[model samples]
Target: MKAGWTSKPLEDACTFINGLWKGDKDPLKTVGVIRNTNFTKDGALDDTDIAFIEVEVKKFDKRKLFAGDIILEKSGGGPKQAVGRVVLFDKPEGDYSFSNFTAAIRVKSPDELDAKYLHKFLHWTYLSGVTEGMQSNSTGIRNLDGDKYKAIQVSYPSIGNQRRIVTLLDEAFADIATAKANAEKNLQNAGALFQSQLTTLFNRRAKRATHTTLGQATGGIFTGPFGSLLHKQDYIENGIPLVNPAHISQNGIEPDDRKTVSGETAKRLANYIMRTGDIVIGRRGEMGRCALVTDAEDGWLCGTGSFFIKPSSRCDAGYLVHLLRSDQCKQQLENIAGGAVMPNLSNTDLSNFALELPPVEDQKQIVAEIEEAKESVERLKSIYRQKLTALDDLKKSLLHQAFSGQLTQ
Candidate 1:
């Protein structure tokens, strides 16, 4: 429960300043940007990946921003995901302006509520209850304005309590950050070690390694593409997902932003359907590298630039994925792709490449070990991610209490 603190209408606490919520018409070749991408996940502003737009700032005077003004992303990414992301402008130590799609909230009533505390609080739940109630302006764009934000009901214990809560949150989240950083670093190092191990295992016995095409090592290798029926017109920002070589990775597949195609398109392209245990080998640009499709992604298709491999009973899919991603196979792949602007390999060409068939037991053992190690690394990542999430929730909980005046002794 929140601390029994007095409450104030948001309208009585802050001033909302917003400019044109339109995309640039006559863009400038150079400009300053106030984008949410510049903001890091930890609530700090980072501009390393920002893009410039054409604009003459002198003409868009009201578009400027100032210190203590909190900027909110009106629309971004997917629904229920990127909406309501908040960024407080505390950098450049000077004036700036919000983007056309963003809104800025500035406090004029410093007496009623602490602006810093409110910034923290608003960020804590800007997407909480408010996001669900928001109506999308377009298929995926949702706009959040000052009026809705100001109507947000908030209560705090006191300014002193709010500060204490913020302090506690900062300390706890800092610890979580350090832990997460270390965990992620360890994951990277472990993955590298695994890759190196695979390299040594195969390259060491190069002379003894018998060469065979991917087709010889497997039952058959075939290309994916439900016959170009999934044309460009059927693709969309929303719908059934299709995974191409770009979607596959050494670590694993990530379908977070996987491309979509219409249901009709998918039906026509049904031949590309990925089975639970299907192993996909890249055929274009760095061909022969592979990734396995798991039960979680049975619905998706192994789209273009990918070849599906169904190995004989002698070959293990897990072992093959690791081997394909290894350096030896990469060399073979490069041999074919040599000196080409686009490294592309066909299924017939891939069938000519080969490697030793380790005993089934050895293959099983190696796959088991790799799986165990990867699971451990993923577990470590999960723990750290949870810790980070909890720390954030704790800060919000404390904010709820501190303003309610219950956090004090």
Candidate 2:
């Protein structure tokens, strides 16, 4: 809509080539093929996991990719991600082609339409939600409507002006990318600092502390009720909360009210009820996922896939929770865990596991220090995460300005 800029259908500006597919043939040839998985979220080819598969010779000849070609994802998108992502094929002309789920777009005339400029415009459209209306879902996979995508209105200035816009965008995006990377690294450092504190504080005290098996330090390990003992029919709305593995998060219990049982069912499973200061830990799948039970969750029943530990007077519950969640303990448990499909912990193995126990007072002090360090680390992570989000927003805003002919002049 800017002065002297003309708008035309994308189909008129470029020729679209449907991608290649492997066909049944006696003799075959292998070539590097780019699939949607090779497409990065940043609209670039990853090239690290390109598939080398055999396809019909004739199909490969017509669909092979070249430098300056734009590969468009016409299918294969999730519920959270939209279809119609376009990535620039910057690699040299080689024996490479895209999958059938994608297509290649080549500018018909470089003199009139700049390929880079067109690719940028399409990228902007996808980011701006303009292509959301141009997609439909089938069999849980989102597909871009080819006819609608071809009819997309692309507004552009002269080739000279388009090249100038591309130059400006390229430089600006490079700087933004650097800033985002720094923010991300800072976020990682924030988390690493907390983990370091846990490792250092625990490992340092562990050297001087008396060692004992978990069975000697705790009252007893109570495994959750088996699936046969707790039937699905026992679960009801607005009933006693059950502390399942999913409910254990960030060193604390976060029970889902929907995953509850009736008072009668809780009474029947009273042996599995958690007490205040008890530690609920996941016994299956991911290791080191454990939480401290608060006063509010004292009477909660431990659901299947978890084990509750009641710390004796000698061991501090908070200290024991942190120890169970530590990387060292996780690795130890993984070594003994068993299951054909998913790793699981046995009560006998967990009880026999050796642990370094500091005096109750010393354990509480370490827990307090860790709690303090966690607060500072969380603050730093929040700040860096905000910066990364702002950088993404800025990139989208600049793209909106560029395609609207407001980037320059």
Candidate 3:
């Protein structure tokens, strides 16, 4: 809407070229084809994961990608991810073409339009939800409407103005990227520091402590109801919660709202009722995922994918949960876990696993220390996470300003 500026549909400004479909071809003689996987989330070309396809030299000559080509993802997006993701190709080494799931747009008049500008604009559109809104889903595959996408009008000033905008955006985004990377690294370091302290505490304690089987230290160890006793069909909309392995987290037990069973079904599986201070370990899937059952999780029916460890007076429940989460204990459990399809931990395995037990008072002290350290790390992580979020918002704000001609102003 500025003086001497013009708005035009993408179709008027560029020509769209479809990519080649995969066909029977020898890998040795075929050229590399850029699939949708080659497009990074940031709208840049990723050279990794390129596929090769055999095609006639004539066909290859016709479909070969050149520098400044903008490839758009036309199909094969899921519900959460939208189609119409675009990436700019800078003509890498070797002959390259794109897949049929994508289409390339080449500026009809390079003098009037810039490919990088178009690429940035399209990326903004995708991020802004405009492209996602234009998508149609069929058979679980989301496809972008080519005609609607082509009709998307973009307003721009002179090519010089466009280049200036691109330059400003590039510099600003680079700073933002660096800031984000530092923030992310700091966040990761915070978590790693906590993990290191945790490992050191457990390892040092294990060195000077007496070892005993979990069964000797715990009053009881029981697996959840077998699949035969509790069927998925027994789940009810509003009933006693069924705590599955997925609900167990390093922090604590997190019961799923969806995995509830009727009172009748719960009574039938009453033997697997969880109690406060019970240590619940994932019987399958991820190794060492365990949590201490709090008062809220007490009386919850344990699902088939979990094991409940009833801690005796000899062991602190919190300490036991931390021990199970430690790498040494996890490795021990994994060593005995067996299943053809999925790793499983049985009651016998749980009862036989060796645990280093210290004095109950010492265990509580260690748990308190670990919690304090985790809290410190978590606080730092939260701050850096907020900073990262702000940086992302700043990037989006800059993009909005750049595209709207506010940057040059």
Candidate 4:
């Protein structure tokens, strides 16, 4: 602790009030309500989607949020995120109350502890992963342990020093946030550049290109076995992997061993087995998700949500995979897509998917050029992504220093 600093339980420094429950009742006025969605990952409030709900007058009077109050997430977290995240409410007093999944923390004495100081400290605790231990889970929703959270010992110097620390953090964090935003933008631009190259290349070729359906270009289009033919009971922990739509990412296959079938089942579904040089394309969900089957996944079974295409002497497998994932192809697939809830691609539609096909040799050349462009884009993205990660680490380090009484005056 610093020389003039004092420490005490958070409950002693602030008053905690549970949020309001939007229950079934009559005779109430509608007001904007802050839900967990209003809280951003960076401990900031996102009020754009606030829900306006009717609340009892008495409940609103007791649960309404005020400026400088810290909103704490008491419930609703996922496997990767933890409950107990705190965001400061700097908005002016309004008819706003937090959801039942949250709680309000009001400073008991502004003369001793600054609200921003406490909010920053609590935010630091969350960023440093201190709150991960102060949580429990039930029925898929993570709940913060209120007893353990309020009992947290918050150490701070005098009010003057505390405000100084907050000011330092605010300035430093603002700069860091700006840098992070730039890095993220650069990263996105890198990917966009690659996509733009593909779109331009394909569009240019389409102008003076010979057109043909995928069925005429490829040897055959084989859909996976029906769900009735392959039961969930056939899945095994370690066996032949299934190339489901989820496994197809970034023009590559990422199979899950847990979502695999036994060798016997794979043999029974041998007709759906994808061989080397074959193209596996998703038939359900998001369109344009496809990957070329390599030697690594030569014998993997095509999942029910996907189908495989055999490249004939006419089409280059590499070129076909890239073409299928391009923006033009995605737009075409969307045109002939079925099912409104979950758009699906029928085998007939895929087989009859129209495309401007170049000569096999020219296709290979275009594939080489596109791959080279992709490599350059990936390298640029890597640098920007690393910068973003470093910025995040810097923020975490700053939080650690601030809480440890290491911030300069």
Candidate 5:
């Protein structure tokens, strides 16, 4: 500890005010409400996607926000994100009010405690997992223990030292943010470069090669069993694995043994069973997403949310998978997809889709070339991703030092 420094509970230094939530109302007359969705991943307030609700003017007056007020996300976080994420209000425009999922914290004595410093300390505590530890989960929704959160202690130096610390942190974090942005851009560029290569290869091939409908080139195409035939109740803990759209990733099919059907159920839906060399395309969301079934995934029961393409000897299964994943094919598939609420691809749509057909030998060569390029791009992506992770760790370290008075030394 540093000389003249003291530790005290947060409640002693600040007053906490719970937020409000007005019920549904007409959009024309409703007031804008800032909910947890308004919170950015960087601990800053995001005004985009603000919700609105109708409330009496009298009730609205009490929940109005002001400059320098810190908003704490007291509820509604998931397994990946923890509750108690704090964001400083810089006095955004309009008659802004907060939702019941959040609370506002105002310092009791500004002379003794700086609002910015307190916000940074709380952010530090959140990054340190202190806030996450104080969370309780019920029915999959995580809620912060407000009483315990307010009671948590924080140590600080004198006001002069606090200002200096905050200034140093502000400068350091700004640099860290720039570095993180660059790393993220580079990561994205690596992926884009790989996609560009894939597009160019396919584009050039399309120019010289003969084109044919997907059905003409494939052995057969079929969708999985209808929802009425196979219900969620049919899923068994230990049975035939079911491959859904979620199971198909860019990498390949990721089979979940837990999401399975009994042998009898699988037999009943035998016509929908996928075999080795079959190309599985998602029928619902992310219409372009497709994966090739390897020997390991053969005989898996295809879920209702997918389509199976049994490739003929004329087309390589791996090449077909890569073709469907490309931007060109994705755009075409998306065009024919039905339903505004949930876009989907029907069997007729898949069978009629035009595809460039090169020689079987050429298809193998193209797949090999793309695979090699993908490996290089993935390596670059991994390096940039590691740098991003390191930058986050660096910020956490700086926060720990600033709060513990090590930075002052």
Candidate 6:
């Protein structure tokens, strides 16, 4: 801050803009508040997948927006830090109305402090001191009302310093964006390269080995025949990692979307434990989608919708996952797909499935090569990921410092 410049608290500098329902406004006919959904990590407002309310309500529910105001999400709570999610509202049309889930901030004067600068300042991690760990009325709905917002003390720099901070944010975000893009591209390249290797390895001519059912190749086979009701309502967290046909991924399972079971209920159903090297096949939606458990996890259980493929001999789990994900395997599985809306592969068909088995030595070599390549790719990805995380942290730090008046020449 400049030596002679005086700064005020947020309470004095800004006021909350609340829109009262206008008379004769029919909440039903009128579109409800627009939400600040689809936010970017850098506090950019992403209205791409915008949602709206159609509920009929009184006119007072609509909150109007203006240029230079900050659009803040009402609900808080998540792995995502909610405070400082400052969005600079700059719609030239300004046609969108805000929902009850958001608050609008109107600065005292746009000329005195740039809207962009203020928005960025509000996003600093220091704001977490103001909003983080706050309580909410309901799940997924977090509220940081105007009162707490006012008590926050802000250290203001000169207009010039604010502009400088904004510029720094812009530069930092640009670099972060570029790095993110590159990392994503790299991840795709890694997957493609691995899939290509599989294709090359499996595309060659080999004598068709004697075909046998998946049951014939494995020593044991059993699904969750418990008839226990797991109708999506029974899923509970920290209980069990439930895999169903819907979760089958070429690479493995979508760890994020799995259902959970209670420890007590899962204890009685422990027979369903999925072991390492188990090949899990989706028998319903996305029929024939398969993934191998590269390693074992305790309490990991599969629902009846998934088919457990047990190998008759000690085979490479990585090799099997790659093979199942290969184009050839998918085509074969798809041909056998059956179901009205959600197709599935029956055990009978799986038993007759065949693959041109490579020599044991070749299988070993291929697995080793793939492991090395994948490890390198993963390591590189981890580096970029860490860098991206650090930069984001830096951004938050700068914002906090600016508002606290610690950011000075």
lDDT of candidate 1 over 13-122, digit per residue (tens): 66666643435555432445677676565555576765555555453566666666777777663644656677777665544566766677777765656666777777
Among all windows of 10 consecutive residues in model 2, the one with the lowest summed lDDT is 21-30
Q: lDDT per residue, candidate 2, 264-355, as tens digits?
A: 88899989998888888989988889988888888999989999998799899888888888877888888889665788999998899898
lDDT of 3 at 351: 88
Number of clashing pairs per prediction, in order? 21, 0, 0, 0, 0, 12
Estimate, for each residue in 327-388, the C-alpha lDDT of model 5 and write its tens digit. 87888888899667778888998899987788888898899999999999999999999999
Task: Give lDDT tens digits, candidate 6, residues 62-128.
Answer: 4556677787665654655554366776776634566555667778876576777767766763345
> How many pairs in model 4 have backbone atoms within 3 A of each other, for residues 3 or more apart or on separate chains, i.e. clashes?
0
Indicate the TM-score of model 1.
0.72
Arranged by lDDT with the best first, the candidates are 4, 2, 5, 3, 1, 6
Backbone-clash count (model 6): 12
- Can you write out model 3's per-residue Cα lDDT over 59-151, one digit (the tens) per residue? 566678888889999998886788989999887567888888999899998889888888899999888889887989888889889999999
- lDDT per model vs. reference: 0.67, 0.88, 0.84, 0.89, 0.86, 0.64
> Global lDDT for candidate 1?
0.67
Candidate 3 regions with alpha-carbon error over 4 angstroms: 25-29, 55-62, 203-208, 335-342
Global lDDT of model 6: 0.64
Q: Least accurate stretch of 10 residues (summed lDDT) in model 6?
A: 204-213
User: What is every candidate's alpha-carbon RMSD to the true fold?
Assistant: 5.7, 2.8, 2.8, 1.8, 2.5, 5.2
Candidate 4: lDDT of 270? 83
TM-score of each: 0.72, 0.89, 0.89, 0.95, 0.94, 0.74
Judging by lDDT against the true structure, name the best candidate. 4
